[model samples]
Target: MSAHPEAARASSSTPQGKPRKAAFAAWIGSVLEYYDFFIYGSAAALIFPKVFFSPDDPATATLISLATFGVAYAARPVGALFLGHFGDRLGRRKIMVWTLVLMGVSTFLIGCLPTYAQVGTLAPVLLVLMRVLQGLSAAGEQASANAMTLEHAPENRRGYYTSFTLNGTQAGQILATLAFIPVAALPDEQLYSWGWRIPFLLSVVAAVAGYLIRRNLDETPVFQQASADQDVARMPLVELVRNHWADVLRVVAAALIATASTIFSVWALTYATSDAVGLSKSGMLWASGCANAVALLAIPLWARLSDRIGRKPVFLTGALGCAVMIYVYLWAISTGSYPLVFATGLLFFGVVYSAANGIWPSFYGEMFPARVRLSGMAVGTQIGFAFAGFAVTFAARIAGPDGDNWKGVATFTAVFCVICAIAVATGRETHKVPTAELGLRPAKEPAKPQISESVSS
Candidate 1:
């Protein structure tokens, strides 16, 4: 959570530099927010079917459990609309505080809910409601965090700084995946009874730690400058739709790449556990944990690569490469080849997709003008994320009892990659643009020169 050396060096006599403290503040806040989001993702796949839902039909249980997971996506855009307004009007800092507190309370509540045996139908009902709350809070979290960091970042290092926010997301995924390792290894009876609750309950610790780090940070100079000028839009959404509509649509299309990620992570876990593949849940969990760990390193490397080249090539490479690799990755799971699965799974999710993942926070945020940047990003991404929300259902239908349908899933994922490739290709390069120039009208006419009294005479 501490500021990096670059950030610290830039923060000196002149305030015209990187906001190291503010960026780190956003980084730590995003880490906490995603921690709350991803733990439920882990639980939805591994525990929720049995823990909260009816135990009758396996297929129905899986659908209902996945439905609970999708519930959060439902609230994402709504939260985006609500929270994003304040982020544009008030400041990125205030929305972040609310996002963390709301996610923390919701996640902690999920931990305390009674099981179906204890409370009957109320168990899953409360779980869905809590997931909706988490979804709503999560809607604006990453955008606000990324906006804070990007605004505070140096012109040359926007990709690098923005990527740090997602590294927090990957860190959260690592923690969420690792949290399941011990729990999944527990005996079936005890695991279902109580083991699964430990990870969710840890939200209290995360919430407190996040608050400590995030509270000390101040508003970014970009927003402060806009405020001082009394120039911020009363309706950021109206401006976003008017001027940045094309970019908003572009980000929406690009975010479909996320479907490949959530499906590969969550639904693939369920597929491996099914009778067709018969992989122990622990083995799958280890694969996920290590893959996420690899991403911690891969994300930064890819982000730096984007800084050197452009985001388009790197993003396309990642999407296309990951699409090709999913076939082998799924094949490894189906064949029960642990060595292959472990290696390829880590390679695909951790390394390949990371190129796309790390670049997007900045890429999407850069698409809009500063005034409506948060609103445009949050609404576009969460809406694009909706496809991924139902990906479990789509993947389930695609894979079915014909578990050999790895071919079908791979083809579907590849189509998604190609679509995103076209989308990101349209984006203009913003790595050199100053934060102040973003979302503002371009200057056209040449400036008039001052005249001396002698020249006038």
Candidate 2:
């Protein structure tokens, strides 16, 4: 008989292996990494301008704080090329473990750093370095985890299974936001002096949990099978570029859907709570925590829907929904309508954006063959996410001096949203793409069977 493709695959991807267990571990691991990541975004938006830098020039201080947040993103594309190769070469588990370690160390050290007043120029300089390290580690974390989970998943259920990754991300965002509830409530003296550090220091627990969970996960079946068969590409980056360039471009463009994540989680949080806006700090954070809380459920629902109807329709619906709602969400923030803020945030981040965010794990992975899945996804996503990381600084610059023209921010975000919609709209529908037919493999029948007749005949 011919080789059993499924039988040759080692690790947790086989029918008999613990696919669910592996996915669960990936979920928890990713959740922890994102918790560390979102905290920097949260701090940059709300606290860094006040505490990390010299506040003597308010405008320069804000710009510098925002620049620190962008530092990590600057390192991400570079990190992606290296770590993506590692994941595609060494397997996903190793990359996941390394990411958790890098993020944890940086966050803990950040908690211990001296502010600008105490350390002068060294404070911001060190902060930028830590953020760069974090960006590098993060560039690989989600892409590798998504590929691992997708490879282990049952062919028919890839979308449903991989949705857990983003669900974990929402859980992380929720935890990070919850961590700040107490910190944001502290007095100004405490907030600037030490309360901010409290959230950063809690990285210890998250790192420990991520380490323990990720260490136990088996390498993905696809990667294991490649190694056993000695079919692993000599250079995954070159292989991906040579054969999968179009798909890489498609994935990059489609990944613009992530704009929804940054716009809601980072931009909206800052705009609503800034002293210029009059909304309380805790109020905005709760809005974020609550919206993602709802997203925890909505993300899975959208993925399940994609598993049924198709990835494109659901994704397009989400893109359009968030585009229109950004207008309303921004308006609510400008007016200080707490009810409007919560309602619109929940509707946009929790429901609309979740549709796109949750579905993309499967959607993007499906575009590449296993030989270059990590390389393709990592490169595509990080390059696309560059816009998101930069959007915070750009949005602030775009904000009118009066800071009331959030309509300008909405317009900027909407143009990007429309671009994302058009890009994804052009891609092939993956909900019906058979497991074996996805990526570089054209559609074909299952390998033919061989049988022998017994003497009884």
Candidate 3:
């Protein structure tokens, strides 16, 4: 066991000035990348079943359309392995740039794709291809952004600094919902034909803005020091598996928390709009947007609290609270009570879910040293997130043909949250640990190097 370069940098302390800048840059990049990713979820729920799928057997069409959204998740683990390796070895700055470009191009192409009416079987095939690219881009974006922030952050403030990446995620969801509201409000013909494409097209602007923001920032000092010391891992995945497999497994289980998100955003939206519930698509979109808007504020607050109290307690509070609150929220939607729907949505998604969502970036990244941090978090979280990506399909099946099984969806969501909480509980409390000491094996005194007699000769 040798000393890691990040440990030496931590002993001296990284410069404090750029952590804020790095956090802001990470925040902006996430907003852009996730905006590209989430807008597809909005469309898959609201527009794609009608526009891209067969009209016969409406229930099956909707399931297939939603399944296309999950196709991206299938690609994520592969992208994580490929991109995370480069992120750990080559540098975070380059990976961030490439992922953003890939997301932007994929999203923009999705907008340009012809529908089932226009292109027959070719339409959905093209749709799935673009979605795979979006998934690939997303696989690396958050992990790399988080690793950059964690490396730059002052030791005591890691939670607060890393929270910005997730705040940006909330912001992106808000933007995606807002973009969909007017389009979702359109007549069925216009919405399916053209209005829905507008949000995907808007991704270009986010791409340009995010690229400019990330391009000028310097690489994190931890990475710079690792490079200077010639200590960069040749194969980060190999090293990570050998030394940090338990942390990766913990991160995978904890990352299943994303299941709650997709269910709320995708499945719940579809369920509310079904004839059984009769909630307006625009209304549900507004509820989601408002929840995410509130989350943008709540994420940083929860993260600051994690910094003070440690990660697991705040995270468990969130995980368990969401378990209870999602039931109330979905039940409210089932009852057709708009006020109750909005209120519960805000509480569950905005407040409770933010507790876990905001903290995981810091908590997971801190489980590895700089040499393997990006690869470890990326591979672990992406594989877990793949489960979340398909949660909508599972919820659709559990709800049956009429889509009225709010209780089943709620039970599914709550169970996922419980598992996530248990996973978080099993990990070490890292808030009080020095940044340099995190993920370190127990220390042993190094034997003094023996002088060779040949050197004296």
Better lDDT candidate (1, 3) = 3
lDDT assessment of candidate 3: 0.90
Over the stretch 46-121, how does candidate 2's per-residue lDDT look in tens digits? 8888777887887778777877887787788899999989888888889989988899888888899888888898
In terms of TM-score, the best-performing candidate is 3
For every model shown, what is its TM-score relative to the native structure? 0.92, 0.92, 0.95
lDDT per residue for candidate 1 within 1-457, as digits (tens), equals 1123322222332145355776677767777788888889888988888889888866777877887888898789888888878899998888888889889889998999999878889999999999999989888888898898888888777888888888888888878878888998999998999898988898988788877777767777767767776767799887888888888889889988987888788878888888888898889988988998899898878888887887788888887887788787888888888898999998899998898999998788877766888898898998878777777667777876644476777777778877888898777876655555554455445788977668544
Model 1 scores a C-alpha lDDT of: 0.81
Candidate 2: misplaced stretches above 4 Å?
A: 1-17, 443-457
lDDT of 2 at 41: 83
Output the lDDT of residue 187, model 1: 94
The residue-level lDDT of candidate 1 at 123 comes to 95
Winning model by lDDT = 3
Q: What shift in Å separates residue 410 of candidate 3 from its native position after superposition?
A: 1.2
Instruction: List the lowest-lDDT window of 10 residues for candidate 3.
Output: 1-10
